[model samples]
Target: MKNFDIVTLTVNPSLDKSTSFRGLVPEQKIQCKNPRFDAGGGGINVSKAIARLGGESLCVFTSGGDTGKQLEALVQKEGIETHAIAVKNATRENLIALDLNTNSQYRFGFSGETLSEPEQQQILEAVSGLKTKYLVASGSLTQGMPPEFYQRIAAIAKASGIKFIADTSGEALQKTLETGVYLLKPNVGELAKLVGVEKIHADEADDAARTLIDKGQAEIVVVSLGPQGAVLVTKDITEFVPAPNVPKKSTVGAGDSMVGGMVWALSEGKPLQEVIRWGVACGSAATMNEGTQLFKADDARRLFEWLGRK
Candidate 1:
């Protein structure tokens, strides 16, 4: 196996197919344009984002059947290194349809097939054998896979002193927090659920994140506030970076792009503040593109520079 500074694991990878249609009708057939395919799922997208920023990370994912094969080819086309473990079931694919009439994007997602106990063990063994500094585990666990799966990965990362960065939701997020992590990015609603709240307001975002940091759930907590921007909370500091205004298109992989930028910046020895800027910059830039294509390097650099002035 090749050496890498960062490694991303996506237990439920997908083949994302996107298309546009004139309008959505209740029971009538609608004419749709040709579909576009993209390799999706959290960790794969983060790898794609890092590659877009001229950084490299090894992408580890479970793949099976023809869809899985196609997903690997699409990811390779983006110049990302991959280590795909074969599974017993075919990989899942998601649909992104743009209704031109209302300009609203509708996303249909399906859960990936469950991984057997042996297969889950294989993933753990693979990560244990990896030589890396950062271990990024993102996306949802497949059906039948326990929520504590990420917590197990967290243990491995902690024992090896590898910085663990997690981007997930619900029980998975809660369980991972129990093991502690280097960083965690959760949206307002997701954060609220973790902290046992009905909801978290934008103004209260920092305080909410601080709660997690103070509890040792995470050393750094980044709460994404959608179009408003994001708040970076740590033991000593709480900073909010406003998101750059850009032409909105699709938000398919914006969060993944953010993680990619922040991780890449961190790998480059940038400060935490600058790292968060890169994250917001890349995430905002990703919204300027269609489907799951992510962002252009030039656009991200432009946004980063613009954000610095603000």
Candidate 2:
């Protein structure tokens, strides 16, 4: 069996389709440009980002029906090794339509298809069988699955000596933290929720993250501040990196890209400061592209260089 240093799990993957049209008129057929398709979902996109950085990771996701087949084909075409767990339900598709006239993007998302008990077991088995150093479980849990789904994966990673990283929200995020993870990437709002606050200011982000670390919820807490860049906080250190200004087109897949960059950097044995820099660079670069196309390697490299000089 081929080995991978990083493994990403997207229990509920999506076949992302995007296009653009002018204006939003009721009861009118809208003429749209040619649609673009990309394999999406948090962990899948993270794997794509890692691959773009000339790194390799196994992307494990659920597959079903035609949409699942399409998703598998799309990721395979990207040259990423995948292990698709067959499910009885068809995979879901997400739509991103850009209004040319208003220059706005409308995202239409569907609830993930439910996973059966046996199928859920398959996902856990798949992860448990993998020999990897880093195990990333991202995205929302499918319908009919408990929020503790990620928490279980966290337990599996812990037992297997894998460094678990989780990027999710709400109850799912809350449950995963109980199991403890190595890294967590949460936006300011999500971090606030974790700490039982209504909201947290940028100044309080370091303390908020430190609280989680102190409680053993996560070893490292990375608070993403959107335009303000990100802050990396551990038990002993806290560092902030300002975001670089760029031509922003879309914010899709930016967080996954950031996680990818950080995980890849960590795998390469980069220090914490450089790791966060690469993450911010890749995430900012992702904003330079539209839909789920993610970030280009050249753009990320340039952004990373620019960040280093700053």
TM-score of each predicted structure versus truth: 0.98, 0.99
lDDT of 1 by residue, 1-310 (tens): 6799999999999999999999898899989999999999999999999999999999999999999999999989999999999999999999999988888999999988989999999999999988899999989999989999999999999999899999998898899999999999999999999889998999998999989988999998999999999989998998889998799999999999999999999999999989999999999999999887899999999999999998
| lDDT agreement of model 2 with the native | 0.94
Q: How many pairs of residues in model 1 come into backbone collision?
A: 0
For 149-198, candidate 2 gives per-residue lDDT tens digits of: 99999999999999999998999999999989999999999999999999
Cα lDDT, model 1, residue 159: 93
lDDT of each: 0.94, 0.94
Against the true structure, candidate 1 has what lDDT? 0.94
Q: How close is candidate 1 to the true structure, as a TM-score?
A: 0.98
